[model samples]
Target: MPLRRVAALLLEPMSVFEYAVAAEVFGLDRTDDGVPAFEFITAGPAPGEPVALNTGGAIVPTHRWSDVLDADLVVLPASEILEEYPGELLEVIREAHARGATVLTICSGAFTLAATGLLDGKRATTHWRYLDLLARRYPEVDVTIDVLYVDNGSLITGAGTSAGIDACLHLVRRELGAGVANAIARRMVVPPQRDGGQRQYVRTPVPECTADSLQPVLLHVLDNLHEPHSVTSLAQRAVMSERTFARRFSAETGTTPHRWLLQQRVLRARELLERSDASVEQVAADVGFSSAALLRSHFQTIVGTSPQRYRRAFSTT
Candidate 1:
């Protein structure tokens, strides 16, 4: 079904950035770009009531909880991560989902969805810092910590901050099409689709290494992704023994050398697929995979989709 109407649910002590993510994606009038316009409205617990924001300001929502029942999509933006959500708001979300409206959450908004028990026994994600807390609080929900977002049919959850943009665009692509999503992304000056997951943004507790220690080797590998690489070769370039290099590599990068190389290759393949008119075989070769078959295998594992399908969905051409 086409997503013609969208309603954003605002709670007290709201996050301005998360609220803006929804407004930017659905509320803006983009009819000139041939993108369909949505009837976007902000709904709160009390209609026409001013709610305090974490940014030291307040917003007066024009609609009440009942306004969301007819919306094609219902968005829950970040608010205080409370142990309990308002029962009235939860009922609204439950009714919307039961009526086939897509439910989406950004950041701590997952807590609100979780409160409705909709995320139970479902795969979901939120900001990396809160993964453990969320899992411990709700054991029934499968909280994925690595990915930027999780899409479970009618339910979608995004990680912190900018990841909300990725989730919003993903929904646009799913309900509308790649063309409309890409047009919105181009106007926002962001990539239509980002490669890899939130794992790349996670903070590791390992001690920092000297600036020049492994920087050169990492840069060289990125520049020479098509070339064969191994621990011995990379260690030699870094002027360290293989054993020492392996240990330090893991300490500095939070992953083994082989895994890091594979991730880089997959990222390069995604770039080529999106912006270049390259066949799967050529893209595989360019990214250092032995064959198109092997590339497909790794690409599917890392990206959750085949290269051909990814290109079909996101190719700029």
Candidate 2:
């Protein structure tokens, strides 16, 4: 399916930000800018009823719950984490998924989708605040952590407010093409893509000179990804002993030098694949992977897809 129709299911008490996120991504017409426009609708239990918002004001949906069934994609904004969601709402989600509609949850909206039992045995996540509760309540679901979003094909879950945008854009990139997603991202002034597996937050909340001082080194490494470099070499360049550099690097980047290097290499490879007419082998070499085989392994690990398939979906050329 090309994802032409989209309906957001709004429930009370409404979450203004997540609802706004859905509206901004799908409700707006972006066709003039080369982004595909969706037949966006706000659906509720009653077509013309008002749903109270958590922030005070209420939103009136334009369509009834039945309208959600016709959508190619169903968006669920954040919902109240009550003892249970409405039976009718849960049924609608199940029916929607059963009919091949992609269901997306923003923030605590995962709780509503989880109630339908569709998320059982599938990897999913909500906001970090609710991860443990979601796992405890739905014992069958494979609850993931530390990631912004999880895409289990038709059922997708976003971590928090901004993650919703990333998830929606990813779906656009997955179905329509990266060009469309890029156009939308540019219009919104956000990154076109962030791997769903990227960490939601770093353990070190405070900024430190260690991370700041390493900026030059990080930038240099990015500029010369094709060159061989290790922690020792990076340490030498930073004018720090290897042991201190290694400790600071972990504190600053939240990952070891080798892992961060691999992540950066994959990111560069993605750009090359999307923007240039380069072979996988060439992209591998350009991004510092020793061979195409090594690039494929790392690309698949970080991106959840092969380079060729990613290019097929995202390539501008």
Candidate 1: segments with Cα more than 4 A from true spot: 207-317
lDDT of each: 0.89, 0.86
Stretches off by above 4 angstroms in model 2 are 195-317
lDDT of 2 by residue, 28-94 (tens): 8898998777899999989889999999989999998887886899999996888978899898889
- TM agreement with the true structure for every prediction: 0.68, 0.64
What tens digits encode model 1's per-residue C-alpha lDDT throughout 1-317? 66999999999999999999999999999999989988999998788898889999987898998888988999999999997888999999999999999999999999899989999999999998888989999999999976778999999999988899999999999889999999999988988898767654553332344647898898888899999999999999999999999998998888899988888898888889989998999999999999999999988777767788778767997
* Residue pair clashes in candidate 1: none
> Compared to the true structure, candidate 2 yields what TM-score?
0.64
